[model samples]
Target: MVTPSTQEKARLGGRADVGAASVAGAEYSTIEHALSDALAAHGITGLAIRADGGIHRFDSADKPKGNRNGWYVCPTLEVAVYGFWHTGEQHTITTGGKADPAAAAETRLAYQRAREQREAERRAQQARTAEQARRWWAAAGAADPNHPYLTKKRLAPYGLRQRDTMLLVPLFHDGELVNLERIYPHGAKKALFGGRAKGVASLVGSLASADRVLVAEGWATAAALHEAMGVPVVVARNADNLEPVARRLRQRLPDDVTITIAADDDRFTEGNPGATKARLAALAIGAKVLMPTFCPGCARCTDFADVALCRKERVA
Candidate 1:
């Protein structure tokens, strides 16, 4: 039976044999002691890196808290960030101001070791998950006319592959397949775990010499707009990622190409993160915002896809 102390150690990267209780304080002496504490186990689980070049931690991989990365250490910014998803505790430490060269070097080395371990873990996990996505993508037939998500959304699958009953959308970054988002028949969705997500997005139509492009939070929503407008849609996967993915897209495309931020109006949510973030992203790149219009008393509809489905139903 796992004791409370043991469980806590596991969550803290499972090196309790050399953890805070054992190595910290009067029990150990010398510079080695300080180095040990600074370079805690940090574990292989719950480890991920953002596209913005930050190392991150999650509470648990099995039951992940999807708000933001739990803890992150940014080497470039010379900062370390810590936050708990449940209690909302956050802290940041800037290591750049250290005056002692030896101490600073020690600190850098400690963090470097920890970062290397976590990065190795990330690469391995991504390789395994990417392979799985590839096999699923390979076996999937073209989107069927009667696939539930397609039929319900009134959208066609443009190169969207499926495995079994789940719709698979390949997420890529810099022309490499890094992750995937699987959509259920009822519209429930999830992605393969332990892969880089920030700035990673799915594309529907080819951007080859296109003058206009659209970006949105979800694949279904992108598909809806692509069908209606005949423009390429980039799926940023989530609202929080709009800015990162949009910034990258802006940098990649020509200055003349019009990039529209198609936002989801989360009317039911307080602060409406979707629309707010989309606008901010658009503003950052001097792009335009395209929001969905809802019908009278349409409290249930939050996105262009929802509005389109509602209209299609009304017409039928």
Candidate 2:
């Protein structure tokens, strides 16, 4: 009986010592703290850390509320990764003094996996949004020519459809309808969430049998150019998209078809982004650039549509 009691006490002491060591290790190697510090360095704060090795999304500090542009993944107790999808910002945190070769390799693999997962999810979301676009477009009616936006812009409907007071501008990519730009009566515009926009475009007229084509930034600019020049106009939707849309058109059209980028002269804006992007796009494809030239002493016109409307108003 005496021997048995002594052995039991020795076993209990050993267990207590192991438990204390484990607690000390946990206190010293807190991965969550390191991750929090890393995020703080990027101005991202107030996020609950998830250590399950799964991607978690949160709103970025700079974006609007509910944007959820920030995401993080903790693949192991020692490694964590986070990024902002909107800004393409990524950061990683690791515990311990310096990462060993194996730990570094593991972190790289985790980062790659996170990126792949994000891409897959993005593709799926885009597919769903595209299907929704098709449904809404098919069920809509022809755009009312007297709509406020059309009347204000002095543009015709030009194959646009309308649902209630909102005009739907269909965007296509790879010869498939992939998105829609909803233009409200107040001139506000929005594209479907998760829908593809890069390299997508809207057309104001037929390109078939045409010897020349013009690419413009907005629908109104494209419409004005098409109406004046009697040439099909491709609406790249914005300055940033000018290059991608022009590149795709160059690839699809025959070599003899001359491509011209109709630029918006944003004189008031620093760097003149519209004209700058247009010139870059034109240079990329060996195309010509056409910028709207405002009248003498006129400072209000920025694009072809604005120039046309301003001139017409002056004449009246």
Candidate 3:
């Protein structure tokens, strides 16, 4: 018969000799399911557990108390629980603690369950976002010829060489392409703007017959406002470009025409170079500036596109 002390020594040696065990077939699904079952046993819900070569803990429904450290514990002879914090690092406990072994194991298992779920959810969301981007590009490629903004040249510039269907160019006014900001389906890093050309000019010529013209940085906001109010609009491309564009506009437009600069809230913040540039531009050009009534939950008011996208979420 194996003595208790001898068995304990063997068990301790097994954990200490990390290289002795091979991790060749450690499937995340198996570990994740085990962690989920463990949390359910402990009456904890909405916890997530993740595992690569090891396990991690997270809270899916709420932020956990404490410093958001990933905690890990070995619950069985073969299973270990691990946790992850926002920084994507993992943590584990293999020694003594204030709590009893069983309670500590339960806590660690709960954390692992939560971490696994979070990782899974993050991957799912990324997949969905990619799919949405693909659909947007396809739709852009098939743009209607009769549409005022849709032109073959405009669509051709944004088409991805690798994926002809994907267009990175964003629609600014009706269908007019602005500054060629980015080519789509290629992803964020591939966004290209009209070099030195302000995006606001995309809508400058398309404005309604009004004495007052409203200007913003982003194409989306300009388009949204134009759609909402039958008024003339100019998009500055970005905050820094606004002043120069405004100066040019002042020269071209009738002297009595009122110009309003749409100030995005981001400009007022301490370290925004773009906002600082816009302020100087507005001051020099003698243009009246107006801020959106609602703060768009970010730094700058670049346009009405953000307002429309975020308004429903803000209200809810």
Candidate 4:
């Protein structure tokens, strides 16, 4: 009988003994397989590994469908790096091979490059979007008083402009017009795609020569508060932005200027995020928290705007 070497015997037995360990049902037969399994573990699946030491991106499971926020790169056959842009999450993996510090270093450099590239792209997109916003704002006409949205909300235009059928509420960042929140007739609202919205806000009344400024979540809420109390109001747009907007307003005004955070009491939603975030924002700036005081047995009212409209309807 012919004696077979250890390698030949393994081949003859239909198995390759490359000393790769298995984990979580992932076959570590090769670097490509190992990387694919690691990605699947993070809920990112159905991706074809290039294995050519190049960066690749795919849709992240946590984000909406078709959003390619997840990225991975294999700097060498042994080492790979991966991350999600939306959440700033990152991970590293290596094949069942000898530890190579040089390969690990290459992976780290690749991740840094990926992050820099993303930031550059984001800045470019924001710049283009801002230019478009300015053009649209300049061309829009004053909002008609009888528009369905304004009538339904029982609010005056308050200097809001109208483009076609959409009501345009100008958004400012550092006193520059950077975006517009378009409100449709059916009450839907959206900002321009790729426009910067964080820390941006709208003004309901003039802050000049004013000692008290109120920050509220929505434009209608700001309008209602301004009309009721005759105080300048800043519209933060949403619950998540309450803190950033409040902090900026506090810094811009004089020390004696009092800021009241008018919270939307989202009593129906679990945890009432609006009221919670509003209190946090007020605490941050030492501002007073003002929550909506609903009338007796009123369950549908949530914010200042809702209360104002409800009272108007009762009078009508």
Cα misplacement distance, residue 179 of candidate 4 (Å): 1.5
lDDT of 2 by residue, 1-316 (tens): 0000011111211110001101223332666776666666667787778788888888888878888787778787876656777776555555654445555455456657766887898899899999999999999999999999999988889879999899999999998999999999989999999899899999999999999999998888888889888999999999999999999999999999999999998889999999999999999999999988888999788999999888778887
Which residue pairs in candidate 4 have backbone atoms (N, alpha carbon, C) closer than 3 angstroms, thus clashing? none
Full-model lDDT for every candidate: 0.69, 0.80, 0.47, 0.81
**Residue lDDT tens for model 4, 10-39:** 221122112222474343556677768767
Largest TM-score belongs to which candidate? Answer: 2
Model 3 alpha-carbon miss at residue 91, Å: 51
Which is the better candidate, 1 or 2, if ranked by TM-score? 2
Clashes of 1: 0
Arranged by lDDT with the best first, the candidates are 4, 2, 1, 3
Report clash pairs, candidate 2. Answer: none
Better of 2 and 4 by lDDT: 4
RMSD of 4: 8.9
Worst 10 residues of 4 by lDDT: 1-10
Give lDDT tens digits, candidate 1, residues 248-285.
99999999999999999997999999999999999989
- For candidate 4, give the lDDT of residue 308: 95
